[model samples]
Target: MTSSSKTLGEFFDSFECEAFRLETLDDYSKSGNVDAYHAFLAGQPQPSDYNAGWVEELRSHTRAGKRVHRVHILSRPLTDYLSFELGWGYRKNSTGGEEFFILDITDKPNPLAGVPDFWCFDSASVVVMNYDETGKYVGSALLEPERVVEFTGYRDTALAEAEPFVEWWAKYGT
Candidate 1:
């Protein structure tokens, strides 16, 4: 397995029996072209079982006092599809006294080909992203946000670009 996968596996294993809340795109329900945006905003029941293992793992980590945040970027078409079919929205989990945020990155324009960058999760005080020498997303790193910001000026850009997602999350996510 790749090192990233191994690291994630190790993290999960560390909290095997802990209890944490589950939040993901899968947590939302989907129908035809109408994502139950209202339902999601209202915190309705989950309608599907996809990503169950991932959900469990997240819950476990949070239970073990680890903050868990995730981001998924979708193509515009897929984003529309999700918006229409499922009530995909943002949701926050307060576990272990930590808040985890999730956002959809499909709408934002991609950075330049050689722009090295990272995302800083403020709640966790952790920076995570995949970067390469060519400025491509090649691997994920877990580090301090200040380091990423000081090194790449990515934090401000990320926060600005993420505003829409954050707004949507606040409105639609539980």
Candidate 2:
């Protein structure tokens, strides 16, 4: 399918080399997994099947030697959602070989300020993620080819300034 006709989900299926995501929000409580998030808040044990579908998808990509990774831009004293995400989501996802990075800007200024969350596929297709203030999934926009270069640079900067999640978690994860 042509880029014009391709959706963000389709890009995940079609990318040949790597998929990079830049996460800027701290709270995605309204986006998905509401039940799980609520359970986490109640101090319940995480279900073994939590996030299973996404874990399987990550395995499909990483097992083929394709990279599916992301850098989450966040600050210290993580929000409840961030805690749940890193504590549960990222930890489980990593078991499937998906890589994670942390861009902690607790003291330093945000390097990619004002940039919306997005996913860049194979450094070719850029899809801008739109979310409501409450972090609900609004929709996504697939940018034209000309905007790919800009998003690629954003990805590069984020990766360069971010620390591997393991190290960050070792020092800061609670």
Best candidate according to TM-score: 2
After superposing candidate 2 on the true structure, give the runs of residues whose Cα lies further than 4 Å from its correct spot: 1-3
Relative to the true structure, candidate 2 reaches a TM of: 0.97
Provide the RMSD of all predictions against the true structure, rounded to 1 decimal. Answer: 9.6, 1.9
Residue-level lDDT for 35 in candidate 2? 97
Tell me the TM-score of each prediction against the true structure: 0.37, 0.97
Q: For candidate 1, what is the total of clashing residue pairs? A: 9
Worst 10 residues of 1 by lDDT: 19-28
Q: For model 2, what is the error of residue 54's alpha carbon versus the real structure, in angstroms, after optimal superposition?
A: 0.7
Q: What is the lDDT of residue 131 in candidate 1?
A: 38
